[model samples]
Target chain A: MPAVVSLSNVHKSFGALQVLKGVSFDVAAGEVVAVIGASGSGKSTALRCINALETIDSGEIVVCGHKVHDPELDRRALRRDVGIVFQSYNLFPHLTVAQNIMLAPTCVKDMGKAEARRLAEEVLAKVGLAEKADNYPEQLSGGQQQRVAIARSLAMQPKLMLFDEVTSALDPQLTGEVLRVMEDLARGGMSMILVTHEMAFARKVASKVIFMHQGKVWETGPGAMLANPQTKELAEFLSNDL
Target chain B: MSLTPVHIEFIATGALWTVGLSAIAFVGGSILGFALALARISPVPFVRRCAGTYIQIVQGTPLLVTLFLFYFGLAVVGFDSLPAIVAAGLGLVIYSSAFLAEIWRGCLESVPKTQWEAAECLALTRWQRMVRVILPQAMRIATAPTVGFLVQIVKNTSLASVVGFVELAQAGKLVNNTIFEPFTVFIVVAAFYFVICYPLSAWSRSLERKLNAGRR
Candidate 1:
């Protein structure tokens, strides 16, 4: 299977602090890749680079055939094929949940209003928030708003979804609800790259897990590899992760 | 002669002109101010700097001076027979647009970067993100200040009298000149200004309260 995402020798820095140094990874189509690492290990930066949120100092990233590192990148077209959900659940406070979901479909895709409404309904139901459609963002709990954020992205029918610590703000119970929604998406075979600290979820649901340490891919293997880490950096990380 | 019906009628007409001048200033200012605010935040450095300098130059000068510049300065530079109302209206539009543009730029910038990121990731073009996402959110924060600024606009119309545009204050001066009733004639003019400004202030206050209520 062709890779849905591939990053080679990626390097990035913020001022003098180098965040991603010589990082390389590939996520095959329909693959559920979980990136786990310590804070400041460059996991989030890698994910952001994949989406072109941060320009890389050097290296190449291709997502759904869009060259993210290229200066001539059609960023809007690259974005059309990608969807990202942030930890803060950045739903438009002025819009209702249904309006939030319908926005991209109607605005970007130029879908008819009626069709956008149907798409909103479909995505809302997928995230199990159909009844909350008319409510404003502040009217919902954090988890529900995050679900709405996910539904909003899903309405665009993206080829890949990037979840950046999406459940970090929620309580464990709420995290479970969001994680379950992601699990359902995984079961439905949507390609995903998530930067997460949820070790148990990563082990249970991820087909591939990449352990990142100090801006490089330290170790990578299937979910079961967590039980037998190949390197001491990853072993120490797993011991400390719990 | 003491203040009479004809004098009251004259003042009323002046009040009407005051309102008309304010309307012209506001409508023109809002359109130009919206453009200026967009320029202030433009991605290009040169565009941003150009807008900033224009706003700075207009804001640093007094409203009276701006009125003078438009009314007298244009003729000094070789233009012919400018209308008083046009001069006053031009001055007010230029002055008000600088202020309105700054207020609106701050409101637009206050929207969180995350909201912008979310929209961009949704594949919204630069124009779509602004019109569809950013503007609606910024307009919410802008309403009370915009309405509050309307009171300033109405009050500032009195300055038009200096340009011989014959608004409320000019009419009061004419009545005062004739009746020599400084207290009574001016009191009536102040009342007229009050009548126009009070409701706008009250609406701005209530909008502020309601905006906070929504947040809560």
Candidate 2:
């Protein structure tokens, strides 16, 4: 199968500060790719670019065959096939968990309310938040809210999932809860690119590991390749990760 | 001179007119204000600038002047047959719409940007994101301030009296002139205003308190 997402020499800048500098990578169908980097390494920016959340100044980004850098790109169309989860959970606080999930399907897909509610139930169960469907986001703990956020994304049945430092805001116990859900997605053959700080989880669940430094993809190999660092930067990054 | 029964009855009629005028101003202002609020944040630069200029001009000018402009300025431009009440209502609408739009725009922007991103990523259309996700959240932050501003609109309706709309303040002036009891007549009018405004002010405060408590 063709690559699910491919980025060629992507470069982005915010005024005088360059965020992503000549970054290039690809993820095949059903492949789990983990991008590891320190803060400001452009990892999240890269993930955001794939989803058309941020316009790249120079690059060729093809996600499920949509030209991301094209000025006339259909953003909403691209987003339909890619679901992204944020560190802040970003659930609509006004809606119950079920309503939050149902909103996209009902509003975008024109799915009837009954069908949308059922889709919501299936995703909530996948995230292990079946009973919390009636609760508003603010009523949940950090971990539960993150799980609901995941379930909300899953309802879209996206071909590729993007996780932008999703577990960074959670404590250890809550982080474990979210990580398990991610590992479950990986085992079920969901294609995903996650920017994560959880090195062990990244190694175990991500089929490919990409280490980024200073806005460049410094080193990339299979998950086992992390044990044998090819670059001084990779060695330092892994050590600092501890 | 002292107040009489007939004078009190006449003032009561004026108080009723004041309530009616306030309602007209608020309902009319809110309908236009909602549109102006949306325009102030429109994606097109020209539309946003046009809204900005309209708001700035209306907000900078005094409400009394706004009333005069509608009542008299249109005549200067040759459409001279407008009634006092219509001119008065239109002026209040212009004055309140600008201020209300500014208040609402602030509330809409105050919602975390993340919420907007999340909605957009869901593949919801721009209209869907605004109606389903953003406005519900905005309405929460908007309530106290919107109501708080309503008190100002209610009090500002007195400016309509200068155009001879015969609302409470104008009624007081007419009574004072006839009875030569400025203190008693204006005091009663002030009492009418207090009665109208106190409950709304209290409600706005209670809403603000509740919002803060929820945040805590």
Candidate 3:
């Protein structure tokens, strides 16, 4: 099957600081690719480029058939096919959980209020947040707010999901809940690319693992590859992660 | 020429004109102010500069000078015989819009950067992101200051009297001139100003309290 997400020779920089240099990866349908690296390794930049959130300096990214690098790329359509969750759980504090989820569909898709509300409820239930739909973001715990952020993305029903250190801010117990939701998504055949630090969770849930070092993909293989690091950098990264 | 109940009634009616002028200035200023705020944050350098220049010029000049410029200055330049009310209302709109634009720009910027990123990732159009996400949040931060500004608007209508508009302060001057009772007449006028301004100040304080309640 063709890859749902493909990045070839992706290069990105913020001014003089090159973050991603000639990086490449592919995520086929229903595949879970966990990207693990130290901060500033460009894993997050690579993920952001796939969603066209950060435009690439050079290279090509095609997500769900949209040519993201093309200047004329239809961003709305591309975004509709890709959902992203961030570490900060950037929920709209002024909106209720259900309203936050409903906003995009109702505004962008012209979905009727009743239909969007139903979708909101369905996604909230999916994230185990059905009871918190009417609550504001500030009223919820950090984990709960993060879950609502996940549900907000899920409500869009994208072809692929990008998670950027989504559980990094949560405690261990809270992280477990988020990981379980991701595991459920993977089992339900949703394609996902997650930048994460949870080694055990990555090992268990990631079908493939890409270890990044210094803006390049240093090592990649099945989940078991993490158990036996070939390069010293990978070994050091894995040890530090533990 | 004596201080009579009739003159008090006339001044009270003039207070109505003061309220009307403030409302016109605020509503008109709010619309223009919102546009100016957007221009201030526009991505294009030229548009941003233009808005900045407009703010600087309006803010630098006194409201009295602005009124004179609109009333007498326009007459000097061949648009003769404009009504004093039109000139006064237009001057206040221009004045209030500049200050309001600056006030609202701060409110808009106070919304965190992550909120913009989050909204953009959702694939919302620029207008959608602003109306749905940014502006709603900014409105909360703006409410107290906006109400406080209204009190300024009320007091500033006194300046409109110079252009021959008979608002409260102008009416006070006419009564004082006729009755020769400057102390009594001016005191009553000041009382009228106080009555109009105090509730707005109280409301602004209450809104500030309500907004901060969630933070604590």
Candidate 4:
């Protein structure tokens, strides 16, 4: 099957320091792929490059068959197909959860307000916070806000979703709430690329796991690879630093 | 000499003009200043540079100089029949826009980079992202500052007296000249300004407190 997302020799540099040095990976349709790596291993940079948040110095990042390497590429169209959730859950503080979700659909997609609000309500219900739609981001718990962020992306009906260390910013219980929503998305056949430190979730939910170390893919295999990683880097990565 | 009721009414009339002019400047300048702030952040390099130059020129020159330049320049350009109210109104807008543009630009920049990324990921165009995401949040951070700028605008309306506008300060000067009551007339004029500016200042402070209340 053709991959939903593809990256080849993705090199990114911030001044002289290169973060993603020739990183490559492929995410198939409806697949939940976790990219596990240590801090500064370029996992987030790779995710960002896929959405053109950070320009790649040299490489190709194609999301759902659209190449993002060219500066002239229609970013807005590229974005409509690819959704991203951040660790911080960057919801608009001024707007309520429903307004946040309704913004893009009504404004970008040009959907009617009533239709967008209806879709937002449906998605908010799916995320298990339909009643909290009127609450502002600050009024909701961190976990609730993150779920709303996820729902906001889902409301856009993106072809692929990228999660960059989403739960790393949450408390343990809060992390569980977000992970539960992600699992629901996974089961529903949504394509996802997750950058996470939660080994157990990665092991259970991920169809494939790519172990990145020092800006390169150190190993790759099925979810069982987390049980007995081939490389020393993967072993260390899976081992609890505690 | 005992202050006459006529003197009090005279000051009151002038005070009303102060408020009217301030309302004009705040509303007019805010609309123009918002666009100026957007220009400062525009993707086009030349637009950004032009905005930067505008900000510098307005900020570097004194408001007094700008008022003088505009007042005389209008006459020189054959619009000599322009009322002092119109000339001074134009001057205050230019002055207020520069300060407000800088204020709002800071607020806009304070919105997290991740917010922009997330909006882009949602495929919202630049304008959509700004209207939908960035500005909403930025406006939260902007509210107190924008209202606070209103106080400055109100007080600065007094400066219009220099251009022959019969606002409170200039009206006070006229009354004081006849009565030789600089101490009393100027003091009352100052009180009028205080009354107009103090409420706006309080409103701004309350807004700031509300915005920051979520932190704890």
Candidate 5:
């Protein structure tokens, strides 16, 4: 199968600060790729570029065959196939979880409310939070809110899911539950590009591991990079965490 | 000179007009303000520029001057038959629309960029994202300030007296001229305004407290 996402020589900058320096990577269908790096290493920017949330200064990014940053590409349509979860969980605080999940499908897809509600139920169940569908985001714990965020994405039936530091905001015990949901998602053959800090979860779930440093791809290898360090940067990164 | 009961009755009626004007201003302003706020954030550069210019023009001018412009200027254009209330209403609508638009724009922009991305990820169109996600959150923060603006509208309606609308302030002026008691009649009129505006100010405070209670 073709790669679900491909980024070639992507360059990005914010004013004087160069956040990404010719970064590039690709994820195959159903593969879980983890990007790890220190703060300000551009891992988050790379994920955002795939969805065209952050515009790139130069280079080509293709997700599900649509060229990101092309301006001519049908961005609204491309976005439908690319789902993202933020570190903040970013649920609409005013909306109930069910409404949050159903909003996009009904409004953008023009689906009927009844059908959308049924789909929301199915997806919420998938995230293991079907019981909390009627509650607001503020009513849920950080982990539960993150699960609802996952369910909201699942409702879109995206071809590729980009997770940016999903568990970085949660406590350890809550972190495990969210990780489990991600693991289950991986097992179910959902292609994902995860920017994460959890070394153990990265080792277990990723088919390919990438380490970034100072706005460049520092290293790329299999999950076995956990045992066999390639660069001094990677060694120092993993050492501090473990 | 002493105040008569008729002067009190006239001032009370004028106070009622002030209330009525405030309601009209709020409803009309909100309808236009929401559009202006949306325009301020529109992806199209020209639309955003036009909206910015409109807000700047309206906010920079005094509402009293606007009332005169609408009242007298329209007469110069051969529509000399328009009622004072209609002219004043139009002017107040324009004035309040700018202020409310700025208030709502601040609230809507306050929503985090992440929420927009989350909506985009779901493939929501621009309108859907705004109506369903952004506005709902914005309205929460917007309620207190929107209500607070109503007090200003009530006070500003006093300016309408210059155009002979005969709302509360106009009524007070008519009574004060006949009664020949400046201090007594005007004080009663001021008291009436305090009565109407004070409660609204207190309610806005209470709402702000409720919204902030969770933070504490």
Candidate 6:
């Protein structure tokens, strides 16, 4: 299977400070890649670059046939092929859960209200929030809101999904539920790139794991590599978590 | 010089102009103000600067001066003999647009940055993201202030009287001159202004409470 997402030597800088020095990775169709790293290690920035949320200063990123680094790239088309959920959930506070999920489909895809609502129901059920469709984001717990955020992205039916520290804000119990939803998504053969700190979940579900250190992809392999770290940084990162 | 029912009726008719003027100014100002707010946040540096300069100038100059500028200043430039109503309406539109633009811009900014990013990730166009995701959220933040600003617009229409437009205040002054009962006539006029402004004040407060309730 061809790679659904490929990042080659991507470099990004924030004014005077360099965040992502040289990062590269690839994920094939139906592959689940978990990018694990310490804060400021550029994992999240790499994920953002894949979606063109953070423009790369140099290097190349191609996601679902869209060349993301090009200035004249069809960004909207690239975005249509990619769905991203943030740590903040970012659900529209004024909209009900169903409305929040349905917004992108109805507006971007020009899907009819009935069709969007049906899609919302299906995605909501996938995230295990089928009954909470009419509730607003503020009314839900952090886990529920994050699930709604996931379902919102799923409604777009994108070929690739990017999650940037989605459960970082939630407590342990809430994180469990969110991790379960993601596990289900992986089981369903969704192509995913998750920037996460959930080591146990990453070890269990991620088909490939990339450990980033100081703006570089220091180590990567199957999930088993996390258990037997070859590098001192990976071992140190794993130790800090425990 | 006792006040007659005919004079009361005339003043009542003037109140109608006050309401009509407020409506025109508000509707026109809201449209212009929305554009200005968009300009205020535009990615283009020149557009943002121009919008900033407009807001600063309009906000700095008193509305009374703006009214005079449009009413008398326009005539100086050879657009002479414009009706007092036209002059007053134009002045209010300009005045309201600047303030509304600022109010709306603040509301738009208050929506979290994550909302914009999430919408972008969905592959929504800029317009789609704004109209569908951002504006609906901003509108909730904007309602209290926008409605509160309406009271200011209605009260300020009284300034139109100075330019020979007979809105509520002008009508009151005219009735006061004839009856020579400054206290009673002006009191009635004040009552009319109060009648128009108080409900709007209450409505704005209620909206603020409702919107804040969700946050809590």
B-chain TM-score for every candidate: 0.92, 0.90, 0.91, 0.91, 0.89, 0.92
Runs with alpha carbons beyond 4 Å of true place in candidate 3: B1-3, B178-183, B202-216
- What level of docking quality does candidate 1 show? medium
Quick one: ranking by TM-score, best first? 1, 2, 6, 3, 4, 5
After superposition, which runs of candidate 1 have C-alpha atoms over 4 Å from their true positions? B202-216
Q: Per-residue lDDT for B130-157 in model 1, tens only? A: 9988988888799888988888999899
Residue-by-residue lDDT tens digits, candidate 4, B1-216: 646889889889999999999988888888889999999999899998998899999999998888887888778888765688888888888888889999999999999887887777777778878887788678778988788788878878878988888888888888887789888888888898889888887887777766654343
Q: Chain B TM-score, candidate 6?
A: 0.92
Name the lDDT of candidate 5: 0.88
lDDT for position A21 in model 6: 85
CA shift of B31, model 1, Å: 1.1
Q: Report the C-alpha lDDT of model 3 over A65-182, residue by residue, as the tens digit.
A: 9999999999999989999999999998888889999999998889999999999999999989899888878888888888889899988899999999999999998888888889
Considering only chain A, what is the TM-score of each predicted structure?
A: 0.99, 0.98, 0.98, 0.98, 0.98, 0.99
Model 5, range A57-95, lDDT digits (tens) per residue?
999899998989798888888878988999999888777
Provide the lDDT at B103 for model 3.
95
Q: Per-model C-alpha lDDT, please?
A: 0.91, 0.91, 0.91, 0.87, 0.88, 0.91
After superposing the true interface residues, what Cα RMSD does each candidate give?
Answer: 2.2, 3.0, 2.2, 2.6, 3.3, 1.9
Candidate 4 residue-wise lDDT, A98-158, digit = tens: 9889988988888999999999999999999999988888999899999999999999999
lDDT of 2 at A32: 98
List pairs with backbone clashes in candidate 6.
none
Worst ten in a row by lDDT for model 6 chain B: B207-216
RMSD of each: 1.9, 2.0, 2.1, 2.4, 2.6, 2.0
Model 6 DockQ class: medium
Q: Please list all clashing residue pairs in model 1, or write none if there are none.
A: none
State the DockQ of every prediction: 0.58, 0.57, 0.58, 0.58, 0.55, 0.62
- Kindly report the root-mean-square deviation of model 3 from the true structure over all alpha carbons: 2.1
- Better candidate number, 4 or 5, judged by DockQ: 4
Most accurate candidate by DockQ: 6
